[model samples]
Target: MPLGRLLLITVSLVASTGLASAQHDRADWDRQRARMVEAAIIEAGVTNQRVVSAMRATRRHEFVPLAQRRLAYQDMALPIGASQTISPPFVVAYMTEQLDPQPTDKVLEIGTGSGYQAAVLSPLVADVYTIEIVPSLGKRAAKTLSRLDYDNVHARVGDGYQGWPEAAPFDKIIVTCSPENPPPKLVEQLAEGGRMVIPLGERFQQNLCLMRKVNGELEREPLRATLFVPMTGAAEERREVLPDPERPAIVNGSFDEIADDEMEEPLPAGWHYLRQAEIDAKARPDDPAIAFKNDEPGLPSQALQGFPIDGRRVKRLRVGFAAKGEGIRFGQQASQWPYVVVSYYDERRVWLGDEVIGPLRGSFDWIERSEELPVPASAREAGLRIGLLGAVGKLWLDDVRIAPAGG
Candidate 1:
């Protein structure tokens, strides 16, 4: 062959190989993302058509760090530096569903980590106003959203506790971080009949709650149990400094009353970080007894498990349990529905038992049966157990009733 012909053949082969490689990479990425959407958002009953469409359209990989792009679509939270987290897709979908946003509504998002949640909301609602306390994150998110053509989103750097007062009377408000309670300002900013979803608790564990304003009264409901970083900035400051007493303490006695050597530096209120192990030990049971009305099929299941329990109720359930492992399975059938498994260890760290139940996909009348299993001694003195719910057309579990056996 002539030298020119040989060179052209070599170049053609190299180009073909590169094209094939790129096609394979794109295919793999698409498959992984599709699985994530099916399992986390769709199966979980995130039925808002616009929300689902926006979630599918946005490329989450672009919002994460380059090193973490591979795991972007996984059904777990991802760290976005600054000790903040981009919430798991399932959580974002769950909270979005709870808000039940309408096409013309204006939504406010607190805690704009990486701007992923805000991005998801921008395409669903008429307008999205988001606030991030960290100046750097706020600036980065604003640029990212702008580049993505999210013209309806407005990003700002400020204390989230104060909310966006200038954009008051929002149709819906969502706080990504956990607060001790819903900030009064957020409630005041809500339009009449508007809803606000927030995680309420101390620094460690928090309860997912929804508050609706009606006739100048706030109606609160505990939806589920979840964990989130505490709402930082002004909210944290407000909690630390309570009003001073009417009078100061005056000890006129000798130095014996207050020995100079007995003094030690006081511990900072926010400095006591709970280790992951301690947090797991203090974690609440996943399944608590809850009751519901109009248990419908094909709709998302409701769990009253997060309500504030009185001392008596807490004692009754033997609330403490060590989680061995938890997994979820998805399905779509006339009755046999998708469900989750919550396995636990006893106080001694031995495998204890597990519970299984159907989630709300449709109506409740179709649900048939639910089950629980206990661990066997052969399995390291701790056995594996499961809760199985039989075929039901559409069933929802509310107010999970869990108590220590023989307690």
Candidate 2:
């Protein structure tokens, strides 16, 4: 054989060997994930099958910085810069189990930290919308989640206190940071019949609160004592409202109650589909009517509407949600993107403000947003409308809620 031909053959063989070695290393990593699940997650008081399965499938080592990659599968949280640490495997599993996510559920996560929790949650639900306050951490985690093929996981950089409004209703909301109290905005964004798991209390004295919304009320159960990064931004200034473990705050702020047979449907009771005509009237004349609300429609989004906030004396009001606008092909830039809108009204059924709160930006991603409206001193009863408009895409809301600030 010619020398040149022999050399080419040798090079081809070397390339194939290198590829095989890389594949082998990947397999080893997969094995490590499984072992971690069994020892760190499954044995750590989390027995949920879906959570266990998701933990096994996700590659934790891929989420950490290169220097700390080998420690990813260990039971502890690791720093991902910006002073944030990914939740430990057991903690992630425990919080995930606390939510009791369903296959069709949409989940919202506050504190994207390393995006590791979102990755762990991706396989367990239809969507995982995460928000990280630190821009650098958000950018890095977003990159890592994408590289790892966690397409269902979406991330954004913003203050998580407001929650994600356009995604205003979530089946579950999990807060990784420790807040002095459950952020009222987060409570307002909790969907009826949904669950929110958060670390509540001051700094190191935080306790894990498993909050479930049922019959328009929040049932608070302290699962364990834990330490976490204190929630920053608006949360730092939050006046602590010590909640009664026996009589927690209620958000009965939106939707109807779910009966045993209606578990498959997204809308709970007290909620109805908003008509396109009503939505079109709100749109600018030059622009097209806001997208239709139905899963059958391409880029399908289902919109739910409820009565405005009941007449009540409240000092502060909050509205928001965890949302994703998928396939949102917008000609406008991010600043002009349509997001979740919280329209305010008065008790006499008269519309009070023309301003809407949220707008969706980009295509196919989840973003967290929130806005607080000051309760006018003269207003006796206020009304609110929570829904998505003026965006073209499949939008999702989980853990939707509406409530007075704090308790």
Candidate 3:
């Protein structure tokens, strides 16, 4: 055989292999994307078909950093540089559904971190005007949007507090970052009866609020509790609650101070993080309990709270709670079970490790569970998560408490 012919055939084989590999990856991404939408979005209670369709159409992997693409379809947030993160898939779908976007509506998005949210909105709304305070993030997002041919999204770098005045009177608005209160300019720019979904409250504790402008005034409705990076620039200066560590201990762990709004999910106060879990509506008046039900068919339900602990002062801690499970089953992975995890974090909120209790399953009556965990030398805070991690079942919890082990 001629050497040149042999070389050409070898190159052709390599090209075909590369093409097959790329196609295989694309197929895997598509499967993950479908599962994400079904469990994280649909089962998580985002019912708006428009939002669901938009979420299905958008390619989240494209907006994420190259290193994080493999995790793009997961229901958690991933870093996208500039010390920022792309919002979780569930959050993006929830917020977009709250906005009630329409085909002819114009949307203004604040805190365009990775442009994923804008890209999701692009197909649902007529136009999307997004602003990012960070120059680097803004430029990269703009480039990604353009590259993806999200022609309807208009990206710019500026203070979101000022909003896009030239594109005033947006029919819908969504703020990704949390502000202590709604920005005045954004309020003014909203057309009458326009809807806006934003995270509003203190630094670590905030609520996802859905507001509507009516009669030149904003009517606020708290949707659920969430935590987001605080809005910078002017909103930052106006922030009233500075970051401060709370005393180490559980608050409202007995589920006594639960929100009683029948219109919304019953949530317990002091539990800053909640997902698919709520205060038991069926509990007796004298006995309140936190309820964890698998609304997401096969997905895990979680409700957790994080607090600061002085590692230098406190050495070991004891956590106690009573739980009951019904028709519970572990998930496909070993880590998925009905358990309570105490996750430790450093001063910068980097996770150190976790101490867990229970793989509780099957129909069981109330069982008292307790565990004592040593504090990491570098730990500054810890999180208490109570739920079925990746498992599906109904669980009830009560009398959760945390204190110094020997105290």
Query: Residue-wise lDDT of candidate 1 within 245-362, one digit each (tens)?
Result: 1111111101111112221211111111111111111122453211122223223332211112222212222222111212322224454344444333332223335445434343
- Candidate 3: lDDT over CA atoms? 0.85
TM-scores, all models, native as reference: 0.58, 0.57, 0.89
Against the correct fold, how does model 3 do in TM-score?
Answer: 0.89
Off by over 4 Å in 2: 1-3, 239-407
Model 2's alpha-carbon lDDT is: 0.64
Candidate 1 Cα lDDT to native: 0.59
Worst 10-residue lDDT window for candidate 1 reads 268-277
Per-residue lDDT over 51-168 for candidate 3, one digit per residue giving the tens place of the 0 to 100 score: 9988988889999889878899988767777657798899999989889889999999999999999999998989999999999999999999999899999999999999999999
Worst 10 residues of 3 by lDDT: 241-250
lDDT of 3 at 318: 88
What's the lDDT for residue 231 in model 1? 86
Which lDDT values do the candidates have, in the order given? 0.59, 0.64, 0.85
